[model samples]
Target: MSEQNVIASLLDDLTQMQSLKTALCIGQDIAQYDLNKKIQWQYFNASDILNLPFTQRYDLGFVVFNDDLNRRSQLERGQIIVKLRDLWAKHVVVIAPQGDDAFMRSLGLTRIVDDALQDSQQTLWQFNILSYKNTPDWLNSKFWANPENWNKFRW
Candidate 1:
């Protein structure tokens, strides 16, 4: 199967495809997954960097690293993990060529598996930002030391 197809199929299995409401597609090629009518996709090519910072936030983001010579550093695109999560989306997914575990981890994304596409010969590596929701209890009003309850409330 083609590399794109393999990535798309794997995405179907890993995520609740129907639950995704919006996405920021960082590469022209990766943007092809827009076949899903459920998502409001904002597309951009690798070389276009200036407009990326202004893009609306999305539920997720996608990028496919390519060796295209014209691309402005595949890792520094119109979009890491786009360095995208926490900026453009709550989560991010990537499809890149194999062999950059340490480098990618430095960017805050983790591999989904060792062999992302077992049958495909292309050897694409899939990565995602494994994030934990931080709803800090101390930050919540119910747990806060409100001035009105200063004497009445006990630790």
Candidate 2:
């Protein structure tokens, strides 16, 4: 599915959730959408993900990994996902290109759907962070194995 369609579908699903009141979209600028008016929306980049303030938790978070050239290292990207999960009160939705499933899964994201075809021969993987606390111990070990991950979260 196209990025627009995926986003629309996600927004639609989120809107149906009575508990979802605020959402943050990271790594992608989707300010043009009308949905922004319906929900409290905030935008951020990968560089700012780590510094994001936790004063106000969001009901949902989205990270769009569309630009391959501007991507961060595998470990760094995984860190971003972890941080996003921490900021979200309920769930985090990630839109990533194909072949990154293993990396995302290692970071504790669950694949919500099979690969969907997109333009430019790209396939999109829709992964969700439902509950960080419920993640498998093995996956959590892989995520926390890097000291950098722990250092980043240290207050």
Candidate 3:
């Protein structure tokens, strides 16, 4: 139920997805669990989240937020999530401490954790782009959907 264990479990789940060919990990390095030789995994600093290139999109993105390390404001964090959602083809997984539920919800991420990890303080959230596309009224007014903002979204 420790932070490392929680991350390992999430990595295990992500690696099991056959459709996941590439992944971008923001805020932490997750290359040690290269379970799939075919999967291309890249790590980047949290600050680079907005500056990443847009030419190539990843199948999945992992964003980890530690209280002591990620001190960005709520609005800044929301922007990061929005940008990641736009760049990811399938899904974006956000791992943060429990207090971020409201902020995560505002960014369109759904908390998918069914049970709490015994001694863990982190929570897992998922934003499935495909599902978001199908949902009614969810994407129409979101800040990221505006065509004019697309240019600014590019790094």
Q: Local distance difference test, per candidate?
A: 0.57, 0.66, 0.74
Model 2 global lDDT (CA atoms, 0 to 1)? 0.66
Report the alpha-carbon TM-score of model 3 versus the true structure.
0.73
Weakest lDDT window of 10 consecutive positions for candidate 2: 120-129
Q: CA shift at 21, candidate 3, in angstroms?
A: 0.8
Best by lDDT: 3
Measured with C-alpha atoms, the lDDT of residue 34 in candidate 1 is: 47
Model 3, 40-145: lDDT tens per residue? 8887776776676676788888888855236888777777778888765468988878887788888888887645453576788999877765655655677446
Q: Sort the candidates on TM-score, descending order.
A: 3, 2, 1
Each candidate's clash count: 1, 0, 0
lDDT of 1 by residue, 35-91 (tens): 455666676655453444554677767766655422455455423444465566666
Please provide TM-scores, in order, for all candidate models, with all chains considered together.
0.62, 0.69, 0.73
lDDT of 2 at 125: 37
Q: What TM value does model 1 have? A: 0.62
TM-score of 2: 0.69
